[model samples]
Target: MKSEETPFEGGPMDGRSLPVLVGPTGNPPKTYRIPVPDDAGGPPTVLVYRRVPRAHSKRLGLPKGWKYEFDPEGKRGGGPRWPWSKPDPAPDATPGGKPDDTHG
Candidate 1:
């Protein structure tokens, strides 16, 4: 039930610090979602923010703290996929057609 005052960067939440609930692992969720009510009273738009390292250790170069950065795409999160469930099927071809593309 602990929370951390996490700072968010970019987007509508820029320069704002909000208390984010931390999990049992003592880290914030990978994605932070904020629901913004529409002015016209339509469905609320959820803004997605992704967690990132705020600073790194000098000696080991490991993450010291965490912060949130705006995700412009705001892709929809998928439901939980258990290990026993079937894996996602592979794409037929690579759309980008890049040489380094694994699905090419």
Candidate 2:
């Protein structure tokens, strides 16, 4: 697991650099989440940051690096709930948790 020193912009994480873990493709996760502890002992608040291009080469227009930008929305379930992105729910499971076999 390789990491890169990534910079963040805007929100509470503005102008901060942190080492982010990159995947096998040598790219960091699209979304970075940070959980801040609640002073009142409630659920922690999560801050979301979205990945974006830091700069592009003027000659060939290739991306130079990546950075994280604060997402104001920062809400849960922010991404598209596309059918392909998620596994389809079982529509015919019996009460015992086995699939109904009459159709099969």
Candidate 3:
């Protein structure tokens, strides 16, 4: 007898599953399906969907260190506005130059 080449050849995903649609408050959003890894046991992962509304909206329950802004035309202006300012660089680094090692 010959062995199967692929793991999904005769597995649970034998063509009985369907795609799922995910989105926020809007008429048209994104759609995708959950992927099944080759190995049954693996590290966990998460998927996030970002949407830009035409008008002002409430905040979302995003994870820590995650940020989002609403832009009608999706343009990058002025450096960064409130709620999304740039973080300070390392202490040994210059304003626009390379870093300096004094303690090393």
Candidate 4:
């Protein structure tokens, strides 16, 4: 018996489950799913989507930072606030970058 081989065989009819690798398939690292909106039964809702900001906009133009937000109400917050702009800078990105030492 080969050590690497499993006793179970996977196929369509066997009720076997398969793992699907998401990357390189046009799937981003993180994805979320939501059902279609219903007006009558569903309450008025707000949706916020956040992502590491991009340098360019696919529709608008050049963009900055890695933080962004989206709401369904057609209103958007100001652009991302750069984490590096603080006087102390985020300690994680500084020398001796361990998390515990960040308070100094």
By summed lDDT, which 10 consecutive residues of candidate 3 come out lowest? 1-10
Residue-level error in angstroms, candidate 1, position 93: 5.5
Runs in model 4 lying further than 4 Å from the true structure: 1-41, 50-66, 72-104
Model 3: residue 31 alpha-carbon error in angstroms: 15
lDDT digits (tens) for residues 1-104 of candidate 3: 22212111113333232222333531323211234454658854322222223244348643222112222343334444667777556677676785677888
* Candidate 4 deviation (Cα RMSD): 18.7
Candidate 2 lDDT by residue in tens digits, 4-104: 99999999999999999999988899899999999999999999999999999999998789999999898555466886686545676567777668876
TM-score of candidate 4 versus the correct structure, residues matched by position: 0.17
Candidate 4 lDDT over residue span 1-104, tens digit each: 11111111222113322232234542222311224456798854443333333467778875442322333443443456687754445545846765565567
How high is each candidate's TM-score? 0.73, 0.72, 0.20, 0.17
What are the root-mean-square deviations of the candidates from the true structure over C-alphas? 6.5, 7.9, 16.4, 18.7
Q: For model 3, what is the alpha-carbon lDDT of residue 2?
A: 25
Score candidate 4 by lDDT. 0.37
In order, what lDDT does every prediction score? Answer: 0.90, 0.90, 0.34, 0.37
TM-score of candidate 2 to 2 decimals = 0.72
Per-residue accuracy of model 1 over 1-104 as CA lDDT, tens digit each: 99999999999999999999999999999999999999999999999999999999999999998999999999744568889988764476555754564775
